[model samples]
Target: MSSIDPMWRLTCVYGELRTENRQRMWNTIVDLKNRSNLPWLVVGHFNEVLWQHEHMSETKRPEPQIRVFRDTLESCGLVDLGFTGVPFTFNNNQSGRKNVRVRLDKAVAIDSWRDLFAETEIKHLTTPCSDHSPIGLTLIKETSQPTVRKVRHYEIVWEKAPELEEIIANTWASLEHNGDLASKFYQQKLEDMSRDYFKDLFAADPNITPDEIVDLFETKVTNMMNEQLCAEFSDNEIADTLF
Candidate 1:
């Protein structure tokens, strides 16, 4: 292999179906750890779950089974690399209460392997044909440029609102500052505004009650829209609404 190219010991496993047989596989992993010093990555359908949350079924996984798996990982010094996209990797494809889902497929690595590719990303892809979802891994190069910051684009409709200037002036006036402000403060405020988009837009003086805030919006929007604007939304709800 080229000197600049990354290299590691990759082991793909399809664990034994029986609980007793799986224990043998775990022992083999411990033996491998003792023999090899190379950065190691192990991935595949383990046929087991580490936590209750990883499984979704009417019947809970046995505590002893989880404990044994945890002990094996601890002995091997292997840590799970969490996945994105689908929450579960296996599905029974059944309906109603009979249905079951589990995160059985996974990727794990030793500490040195994790440090070697610190920007690794794991994802669980949709499985159309099989019962198990395929796990994918992305190893980001250390020399790669950092991700570009997302630019917050203002809605043209916001500029059309007559109250925009007054809202900005009120917010700036509320800040307690004397001389020139540092650039870091401006940068931080920009980030905050991007994160709390709607919350900051409708924010009022801290001294004003929620009722007073509603009264202020009475002139701007109808009762129904104002109600929605005042209503608290969860992060997921906001993402769903915006996207």
Candidate 2:
């Protein structure tokens, strides 16, 4: 009944708890598969496992039930995108042998979808509030553009210092301008200049004491509160703020 440009489809499912009732969900997916040949992704809690290893608990899952789910995926041409991080997504939160965990949540994509998103990665992220872990999907598209190299430059207070020009002249004059050695010498001079500048800039002020700095901060805070925070509000202002 609807169409998306570039012909891609996504279906999100929250399956029935009852195995018998889940047949309707599978039937609906199969019906949708017949309608389009677009890149398709089906994701969510299916309430079913495709393999015995997908379920871990005291009681084993019935093979027939898992087989039905596997058969459904095969019929739809949907393959599990696999995942990173914890193997299981659902936890029963019970202690010891009473505990149960299963990979109930997942993302499955058709071959067409795989071709478009060849660099897809699915991550299983756990949350404290929910028993079920959320999954993160990343799709990276291939690009023809070349990666640009990044160059890092340090911002220094050299312009503020009057002796900067003399330092630059002496450093530049001392460098060996033969080839690569000249480049290395220049870099060393730049590092030395930045280090000396920072040392001078952050050197403690002998004129001011720590007590003076603390008093200044306290005075500023008190003045700010008196000018702004301590100001009385009008009845309309209070009403507006409360509202």
TM-score of each: 0.57, 0.56
Model 2, 1-243: lDDT tens per residue? 346535688999988899889889889889999998889999998999989998998689999988888999999999999999899999999865678999998899999999878899899986767799989888874568767865546544556667667766765677635457666666666677778877767788788677734643434467777778778888999899999
Model 1 Cα lDDT, one tens digit per residue, 59-129: 89998988898889888889999989878999999865678999998899999899998999999987446
lDDT of each prediction vs. the true structure?
Answer: 0.80, 0.83
Model 1 segments more than 4 A misplaced = 4-7, 141-243
Instruction: Please give the lDDT score at residue 116 for candidate 1.
Output: 91
Q: Could you give me the TM-score of model 2 versus the true structure?
A: 0.56
> Stretches of candidate 2 above 4 Å error?
1-5, 141-243
Question: What's the lDDT for residue 124 in model 1?
Answer: 91
Clashes of each: 0, 0
Error of 2 at 50 (Å): 0.8
By lDDT, who's the top model here?
2
